[model samples]
Target: MTAPASSRLGIYCMLGGMFLISINDMLIKSLSGGYSLHQLVLMRSLVGVFFTLFMLKMEGGFAVLRTGRPGLHLLRALLIVFANTSLYAAIVSMPLATATALYFASPLFVTLLSIPVLGERVGPRRFAAVGIGFAGVLTMMAPQLAGKGDIGWVMILPVMAAAGYACMAVLTRKLGATSRASALAIHLQVAFVIVSLGVWAVAGDGRFAEGTDNESVRFLLRAWVWPETGDLAAIAGLGVMSAVVGYLMTQAYRLSRASTVAPFEYVLLLYSLFWGWSIFGEWPEPTVFIGAAVIIAAGVYVFMREDRVKATRRT
Candidate 1:
């Protein structure tokens, strides 16, 4: 059946969320040259906590934070932390194209996990759409893929991150209406704060980072440094974007079937291309257009298939 009005809203939320994710990633990568992963996440999430509070006030107030599912909230927070940090490390250590193409496998994991985790049905066609979308992702980054011979082990980082993210999305669907979006976002930020502090306690002195030539490890073990005025502002911007993104992502999964919204994530690659051309001034190759066309076609097929399902129900 065609998705309900809520599901349509969910699709919009997913699209908005993915757009923010791409922008946030660009910011993260650009900033990584000077700061540690934990510092950026910690600072960004701290700012996000304030944004979350304002969102809560705007949405209704602290009373709306009531939820019987605290344990699930905690689990979701941890999964997101795992996913976020893993992807961050990957981005810092390697080219963005290689890291992203592997991480884009998330929608596939979401679709497969939804079957047993959320008890959602997947038709053959929907499965193909997700696969084709990922294929397009590969097409966009084929050169990077071809050159990563020795770094094959490193590729698993993003895939592991994808699984963590998939579990988090599926759980968001299972949580349904038990919690508000701000509550979810705040809990996640709090978790980030706690974990960031823990990492700080262990590695804050930069002792482990000594002689660490591996860039990813250095990003982890590096001592926290005070940010200058300019960089601090950029980190704060991440907080605002992250707050809005957290709400949109939670709303997306909470309001609709996971399968219905999962494929729309392919839309992120399109935004990546836009950001590349506009912000970073990278010229796109022709294959980028071919890959983009495939991605768009897959998304359109998924939308049409949903309409067909709606029509079959009416008959």
Candidate 2:
């Protein structure tokens, strides 16, 4: 495919992936009250594994799953697992819009990591953008930082999640040259299964259990109960949504330059805002809007700089 066409496809795919992910988060948050996080993840991963295997069979065969870079795939999977756990924990208590806005920092994290990890030269323009982006983060976090609001330390979880996701995004680009998108998706789902099961086993013993008043702790340590029929169906739907999300996002980074497609991820904040209001009747505060606008501006500036750099090289 031509570079222009490939980049367009990558952006569209990313939008679709983000939409599905937003819906998945909405459903997960709705069900978080009745189910443990581990149970939710485990059930979803179990269904995702089957969906992946079926997709593999229909596409070609199991042969596509074979990979020479097992170590890299393992590392990517581990990073995604950490990202999932942290973000899920955060959203259980925080509004979806707030969590999504905080998670948008992932692109900035990617730009910063690319300098050292990929040996890419970041000029003054991009450096300033990164600094501004971080300042936006601090702005959104100011209430908690000043100990004025109830958000407290749980506000940091989404930032941790974004960092893990940034690392995984870089690794996805590195592995894209050699790995099939199916292989990457399957590896991540498998990792989710393993990690969720381990947590379920350990936390079931009462070691992690504390009090139910705290949403984050409740999500982590709550015992699993049998899900209602409606919730079970919703959980199954989440599996399908996640499978689609994983495949499309992997293809997004694999098909074009990450910088070219990264900005479209801001669409997620829009989707999250809709779901937050429609489903949960939650809305972001005025400060969050100001902070999100600053972060989005900084992220767009960084991408524009990268595009200029690429254009100069081509010329």
TM-score per candidate, chains pooled: 0.77, 0.91
lDDT of 2 by residue, 95-200 (tens): 8999988888888999998987788889988999989998988899998768987878988999999999999988987887776667777888889899888887
User: What 10-residue stretch in candidate 1 is worst by lDDT?
Assistant: 147-156
Tens digit per residue, CA lDDT, model 1, 1-315: 777999999999999999888889889878876777888889998998988898788878888878888888889989999998888887666555445556766656776788898776778998899789768766755654577343434556777898899898888778855776667677889999999999898888889989867777777778889998888778998999998887797789789775678668777766766666576665445555676567557756765675576567779
lDDT of each: 0.77, 0.87
Q: List the residue pairs that clash in candidate 1.
A: 2-310
Query: Which residue pairs clash in candidate 2?
Result: none
Off by over 4 Å in 2: 1-11, 58-60, 205-207, 250-261
